[model samples]
Structure formats: structure tokens, C-alpha cells
Target: MPSFHHGAVEIAYLDEGEGEPIILIHGFASSKNVNWVYPGWMAELTKNGRRAIALDLRGHGDSGKLYDPAEYGIGTMAGDITALMDHLNIRRADMMGYSLGARITGWLAYRQPERLRSAIFGGLGIGLIKGGGPGENVATALDAPSLDDVTDPVGRTFRAFADQTRSDRKPLAACLRGSRELMTEQQAAAIRVPALIAVGSKDEIAGSADQLGKVIPGSQVLHIPNRDHMRAVGDKVYKTGVLEFLLRRP
Candidate 1:
């Protein structure tokens, strides 16, 4: 795991294989390994002759953590991705993000479209517009003394994940506090880059993939069969659909 400084913060990342580059951003409480590597995403992309780059978003995995909610703004997090790209001298690359990562990617697509060749929004959907996912309860849950103290169903799940990942919950709580900005319909409609919205069919967290698709002009949607938010990341249909979309994109 190599790392570089994006200002005061150290962003840790994995760069694997070679060809066109694709950056993978994990969901909240998930590291690059947990989100992409262990799920066989690295193998699928690398074997397909693509350079797979994954990063530990600040406050998660090996990346530097900051406790101030102000430091974890959605744009601030997105800037970390651009900084990483600049560090590698990548003019533009395909970008894939899940859940929170998807929100960050969507921000980039709207504000910095030149930096992305294409965008993949996974484990996210119309919630990008509707503006509701983990909220104060999740943040409060992260700060709870123990997982047993987290009573909200979603909060408990995320707290458990944080514990499993051995993550420091304080910074995560701040991150959840800061990175909650939602996209406007105008912003989504303005995205011109080739885009794919992939969501699990059973994902209640991601709103509606079709609705998001309708908002983003010319974007494609893929529904992973019979899976939920957690199980959809590594689904074969998702990998295949993304690969096919990549191949077909100009």
C-alpha cells in the first residue's frame, strides 16, 4: 500500500495491473480491500487488462483521519480523488464509487467532468437526488460506547462494520456528519460523460436505479438480481455489466 499527501492528509491506495485506469471508491466504513479486493473486483478489472486503482478514503482504512466534520465535506472528499489522480498524472480515468463513494463521484461528474472518462454509481440510486441515507442516527451510533448501544437498524449495521474493520469510530462519525450533501436534478441532468448506475434489486438504501437513470441523461442502469445493498458489490451481473459498459463507451 503506497500513499501520498493530499495537503495534510495521507491518502493510501493500491494500484494494480495495467491498461486504462479505473479508480474504485468504497462505501462508508469500507476499505479498498474490503470493498474491491476481497470481492474479486481487482481480479476482474486486472484480468480484463485494466488498471485498477483503489483508495482508502480519508477516515477509513489506512488513510489519515480527521475528526472535524468540516474537513469531511463531500467536495473535500472528492478533491482527494482528484488529488490522487493528479499524483499519478492521470489526465482522466474511469471512476466507480459505492454508496458514499457514489455520492462523491457524482459530485465530481457534475463539477469536474473533465477529470472522469466515465462514472459508475454502485450501491446508490435516486437517493442521490432524494437526499436520505444514513443520517444523525448513524453518526450517533458510531459514537455509541458499544455496538449493543446502537439501536437503529442501519446504524447498528454500520457500527458493526466499523468494529469488524477495526476502524476508529470518532472520525467516521464526523465523516458521516460532513459528507451528506445531495445532488440536485439539474446537476444529475448535466452529467454528459458515459455513466452507469448499478443497484441491487432489493436495495432499500439506494432509492431507485431507474429513477436515477432517468435523471442522468443517457445513463444506463443495471439491477443486480435478488441481492441487497451489502451483497450486490461482488455480484457477477454487476461486474459483467460494468465491463460491457466500459467496452462500449467512447
Candidate 2:
């Protein structure tokens, strides 16, 4: 549970295993532990001889919290990832991210491709380019005083997740308000790193992984059957795809 500074924000992270580096970024309302460690990402990557480095994005986990809408976005969080890499003395490493993490990875792929060997995007799909980002629904849900007030299925789920994780509601609300930016089709096409788009076939939140892959050069899609957005995070198939992709690329 070590932490570092990215400007005024203190980003907490966990570094485990030993080998070539792989940086892991958690999704919205998730920390390194919930997103990667508790799900066994560290063990799998490390056992396969890769370093697993995970971070608590600024507004989540034990990292610094900011309620300002201006404080969070694609570039802001993506900058946090690279800053963490630089702090660890890692110029480049494989990058894996889920949900919002995947979006930040998208920005990384476009803004700092040299800082990544390959990018693994889980729980992201056709929505990566076409449309739909974290909109006001989820944000408003986080601010709702009680679950009884949230009616949208997706918003209710996110609010429940925030409650379950004991995440700060205010920061999360602000994060949702400010940080739903998605990469354009042209931006996705601009990624220079080898990429893998893995999505659950049943995921309502992310859409089609195969469709997203069609736009990114040298990208592949790994579809996990019967899993939805939350279920897909710790799926064995998703892990296997990531490990194999790393092996092939490494």
C-alpha cells in the first residue's frame, strides 16, 4: 500500500511479483485490490514472470480525493498512470485496465504509446468509439441519498457497488460528473501499441468487443460468454486472454 504524488494528489498503489513490468489501473469506484488483487490478477501475472503494478486512481481507494469536476477526466487519470510508471522507474510496460480503467488506457494508447508495450482493455467495447460514456445517470446515483431513489438499473448497480466498497460518494459523484469522456473512432485508430479488447458477450455496459477491435490496428477481441460487466472482471477466460496476449507480445 505505497503511495506517491501526482501534482497535489496522492495516488496509492501496490507493486507485486517480479519480471517485466505490467501496470494495472482499476475502474471507476474500484481500487487496485477490488479490481485486480482480490480477483487474482497479481498472482496470475507474477506467476507467469511478470511484474504486477496496480494503482488506486486518484479519487478512489486510499488515494487523494477531490470533489471538483475539473479534477478528473481521460487525460488526468491517464497522466496518473504514466506518472506512477515514471515513479517506479519504468519507462514502458504492458497495461491492463477494466471499465473506466480501459478508457484511461485508451487515452494512454493515444497520448503515450511509448509508455506501453501492449494494452489489454477489459469490459470495453464498440462504445469505445461509437458513443456512450459514463454519463449523468451513474453520477446522480452516487449522490442519491438512498438506493430507493435510484431507478436506472445501471445507476442503481453503481451506487450499490459504491456502497459495498465503502467508496466516498462525493468524489465518485464528481468523478462520474467530470470523467465520462470516451475516445473517438479516429483516436482509437491512432493507437500505436498492440491492443487486446476483451468483453463479456452479455455486457450491457461495454457493448461489442469485436466491433471495437475492427478500428484499432493490430488488435484482437476475446469474447467471454454469458458474463455481464461485473461478472467479467474476474472471469478465468479474461485472465487467460490477457496472459496469452502478454506471452505472444512479450
Candidate 3:
């Protein structure tokens, strides 16, 4: 793993394969390895002649961690991505993100369209505009002394995931607290780059993919059958649809 400084934060990342680049951003409580590499996404993209890049967002994985909620704003997190691109001398690249990563990608797609050849919002949909995903309860869960102390189902699930990942819960808690901002309908409509909205058909967390697709002009939607939020990440259907979208996008 190589790393570079983005302001005061050290962002750790993996760069693999060749050809045009596509950067992968993982969801909450997950790193590049757990979200992309262990799931074979890196192999799939690299084998298809694409440059696969994935980073550990600040406060997660091997990257620098911050306890201040103010430091983890969605826009600030998105800036980290842009800084990573600049460091690599990449002006633009295809971008894909899941869950929290999807929200960060949405922020970039809306505010920094010139830096993205295309955008993929995985595990996110109309919630991009509706403004609801993990909330304060999830943050509380991270703050809990143990998973047993987390009574909220969503919070408990995230706490268990954090435990499983061996993540430091304090920074994650601040991240959850600060990164919950949402894009408006106008912002979603303003995205002009090639875009794909991929969500699990059974994903309650992502809202409706079709609805989100309706908002983003010319965007394509792919629904992974019978998959929920977590299960959808590594689905073959998702990989196939994403590859097809990347192949055909302008």
C-alpha cells in the first residue's frame, strides 16, 4: 500500500493494472481491500484492461484518522478523492462508490463533473436526494462500548461490521456524524457526465434506483436481483452490468 498526503491527512491507496483509470470508493466501515479487492472487483476491472485504483478514505483502513466531526464532511471526503487524482496526475477517471462512498461520489459528480469521466453510484439510489441513510443512531452505535450495547438494529449491524473490520470506532463515529449531508434534486439533475445507478433490488437502504435514474439525465440503472445492501456489493450481475456500462459509456 502506498500513501500520499492530502493536506494533513495521509490517504493510503492501491493502484493496479493499466489502461484508463477507474477509482473505487468503499462504503462505511470498509476499506479498499474488504470492499473491492477481497470481492474480486480489482481483478475484474484489471483483467478487462482498466486501471483499478482504490483508496482507504481518511479515518478508515490504513489512512489517517480524525476524531473531529467537522473534518469528515462529505465535501471534504470528496476532496480527498480529487487530491488523490491530482497526486497521480490523473485529470479525470471513471468513479464508482458504494453506500457512503456513493454519497461522496454523488458530491463529486454534482460539484466536480470535470474530474469524472463517468460515475457509478452503487448501493445508493433516490436516497441521494432524500437525505436518509445511516443517521445518528449509527454514530451512537460506534460510540457504544460494545456491540451488545447497541440496541438499534441498524446501529448494531454497523457496530458488528466495525468490530469485524477491527476499525477504531471513535473516528468512524465522527465520520458517520459528519458525512450525512444530502444532494438536492437540482444537484442530482445537474450531473452531466455519463452515470450509472446500480442498487440491489431488495435494498431498503438505497431507496429506488429507477427513481434516481429518472433524476439524472441519460443515466442507466441496474438492479441486482434478490440482493440486499451488503450482499449486492460482490454480485456477478453487478460486476457484469458495471463492466457493460463502463464499456459503452461515452
70: Cα error in model 1, Å: 0.4
Candidate 1: tens digits of C-alpha lDDT, residues 1-250: 7999999999999999999999999998899999999999999999999999999999999999999999999999999999999999999999999999999999999999999999999999999999777899889999999998888999998889899889999999999998988988999999999999999999989989999999999999999999988899999999999999999999
lDDT of 3: 0.94
RMSD of 2: 1.0
What is the C-alpha local distance difference test score of candidate 2? 0.88
lDDT for position 209 in model 3: 96
Best by lDDT: 1
Per-model lDDT = 0.95, 0.88, 0.94
Give the range where candidate 1 is weakest over 10 consecutive residues by summed lDDT: 131-140
Q: Per-residue lDDT of 72-175 in model 3, one digit per residue for the tens?
A: 99999999999999999999999999999999998999999999999999999999999666889999999988888889998898899899989999999999
TM-score of 1: 0.99
Model 3 residue runs over 4 Å out of place are none
Each candidate structure's TM-score, on Cα atoms with residue i matched to residue i, is 0.99, 0.97, 0.99
